[model samples]
Target: MADQPEEVRRLLEAIDALAAIEDDATCASAVTALLNDWPTHHARLREIRQERVLALRDSGRTWKEIGDLLGGVHASRAQQIAKGLRGTKRPVKGADE
Candidate 1:
């Protein structure tokens, strides 16, 4: 589609190339390598997204606007992300407490 990002297109092409591999062993090895490297790739993606969010905020976009742009998260949640706060997990409670 015309709206698809170039990076996404390239990723799809890479997946296609992987799917086209003929040798089972080679394909398995390639998949294994990708799995091993995924955490680094995922972290880089998070960094890029956070950078963009900060840039948007610096450009005077409101938290609500940023949240809408970020696929409908709440304004406070957007602000938390922009401020580098990790999402909080609820503490597990003991039954006796």
Candidate 2:
């Protein structure tokens, strides 16, 4: 991070947040820098997110449960990823799943 401009470092952390929420200036800056550093990783990261969601979903874990297991990502984010991976149907609704 030292090599990064001060603005860049702070934005990287901010972008990580935006990835899970909505985007804004900080996220845009961070994303620009991150892509400069690791363009190839985008696809890889997406694939992994999809894979993680699928693995946990197929194992019968709820979105909330998977999120908890996945270092505290929001349950909604977990649900979307998992549902996307499932390809046909979304993950079961409610905590009952």
Candidate 3:
């Protein structure tokens, strides 16, 4: 893929290496290694995405536009990401409250 990041390339290579293993023990070990390392990679990826979303917002892009570019994520959700808010649901304010 064009312009793929080095981390992503390494991840793909690791996946390929995992897939090529025929020995069950080796496969298990590889899978364990991947699982062990996944959280760090996942966090890094999330941080990168948040940074990009903020950058896009700062570059005169509307949340709706960013959401569209992000494969139809809701504008509010995109805004939350740009603001570094986790996707946790909060109680809505009702008229009675």
Question: Which segments of model 3 are wrong by more than 4 Å?
Answer: 1-17, 89-97
Q: Which structure among the candidates has the greatest TM-score?
A: 1
lDDT of candidate 2 at residue 5, scale 0 to 100: 69
Provide TM-scores for the models: 0.74, 0.44, 0.72
The sequence of per-residue lDDT tens digits that candidate 3 reaches over residues 4-29 is 77977997887888989999899999
Clashes of each: 0, 0, 0
Of 2 and 3, which scores higher on TM-score? 3
Which residue pairs collide, candidate 3?
Answer: none
lDDT agreement with native, every candidate: 0.88, 0.75, 0.88
> Whole-model lDDT for model 1 versus the true structure?
0.88
Report the Cα lDDT for residue 29, model 1.
Answer: 96
Error of 2 at 69 (Å): 1.4
